[model samples]
Target: MNQVTGAPGTSRPGGRTARVREAVLRAAGDALVDKGIGGVDLAEVARRAEVGKTTVYRRWGTVPGLVADMLAEMAESSLPRARTGALDTDLAALAGLILKTLADARQGPLFRAIIAAAASDAQTAAALHRFYRVRIEEWAPCVNEAVARGDVPEGTDAAEVVRALSAPLYYRFLVSGDPLDAGVAERAAVAASAAARAGVYA
Candidate 1:
């Protein structure tokens, strides 16, 4: 009987196996960007990555599995939160990051595809939520620092403040089809800061 190994390309953390995983994930991202989740096929992804189909199947097993791994990688690679020494500035920095991502030519469509996939796939939805959770955790410190500095109320919910900063930008990107611009980012930061200061999140 063939020994089933751990997810292909993930068993080893580094070296040639790591490189193969990176290539496969990059190819997967490109495929998701070019064509929605439905367009991502294991055989085609392997071909694009120049890896063997058996390797891809052995590792990812299914499209949702591949997507979950991709989101995990993305969470790992996400930028660190801003440490600007003030609530407003830190919020501004966070808002700017979100704006840049949502407005990006490649990332915009990729996120749209991911969101669409999550709507129909429970695994993908869980992965997407986990990704956001990681990101929110990264930024929560800013709000906590603000509380320490008395910039916001003592009972303010740092995570909710962070989420508030991002909600409008995502709304524009995925709901209203409004433009995502610096002004919008600035407003998001300012509004979230004001609300936090008012103990709206307490």
Candidate 2:
């Protein structure tokens, strides 16, 4: 199989299988957060999950495989985009969601570890890229709606505008080490909205 997701044990988690998968994924996440990529072992994950060693090995097979599945699950479970009619409100809502996730205690550290691991692993990097792509696609419609409302330019790039909205918040979380707060998130939304209206994203 190309990856663990293609392995026999992996289907849509429904019953006992679902519980096991959830346990294993949670264990994997904890291990990754606590020890980084280098420290994630199938045996350790199985032990932490209270599952059989063979189960972990059979399902995930490798550290990268387990991490890939974790990323897939995370994307699948992420919140949907804002439904507020106005573009400003929609952007602000999206920014608020980003701020909430990054400011979260467990999530903040977990994302940092995953991002750091992605820098050194091809499979993990691909998975991380896919995660962001899913998020971008989810929120891009806000900009498209703004175009229809004549709020932003007709040709403004929706995906870019959404990305721009989240960029500053990410910069604080991942670089510059600036404190992220409600004021920071609000500024990002306002700036991105103004730039979109100005056709800077066109």
Candidate 3:
């Protein structure tokens, strides 16, 4: 059996393979943030990652493939949903997380670039949708717990509630160009909680 050694700057399990993937994905993200999808090239990504071009080409095959893998990795590494035992508080926690991400200097640009890319690329759009689906599912349990506790209507759609909580923040981030703040995040959480309790999501 071939022994897998650790690659530099990577801490995940799977040793060298995981390290290479991390390096490549980080480089890809940086490229996307700096430029856009059209600007990202396999050669450039490999150079930035300090990996061989052939390795990158063989592993990812194409820009879309790499981007899809990047989304998968992001889904795997994303933070878990808040388990605060209350619908409002849990939604608030999720809102705060979304606010922080959308307001982040690097992450904000990265997401914008990805979203823009998704608009023009079918594969990227699919991958982006998948990423959101994973995120929504991860957070849906909070609303389900609320239902279990009788905080909301018994038939409330947990996933839709989670999506509702996030839609406003995303709108501000990607569409309105409005300033994102703690207050805005709090309001989104409150609105979602109220709507869920009112059976809007039922």
Point to the candidate with the largest TM-score. 2
Q: Considering lDDT, which of the candidate structures 2 and 3 is the better prediction for this target? A: 2
Q: What is residue 56's positional error in candidate 3, in angstroms?
A: 0.4
lDDT of 1 by residue, 8-61 (tens): 233335788788889998889889878888899999999999999998998888
Between prediction 1 and prediction 2, the one with superior TM-score is 2
Per-residue accuracy of model 3 over 54-122 as CA lDDT, tens digit each: 988887878877788877777777788888899999999999999988888878888899999999998
lDDT of 2: 0.87
Worst 10 residues of 3 by lDDT: 1-10
Q: lDDT tens digits, residues 153-175, model 2?
A: 88899999999999999999999
Number of clashes recorded per candidate: 1, 0, 0
| TM-score, prediction 2 | 0.94
Q: Estimate each model's TM-score.
A: 0.92, 0.94, 0.92
Who is ahead in lDDT, 1 or 2?
2
Winner by TM-score between candidate 3 and candidate 1: 1
* Candidate 3 lDDT score relative to the true structure: 0.85
- lDDT values of the candidates? 0.85, 0.87, 0.85
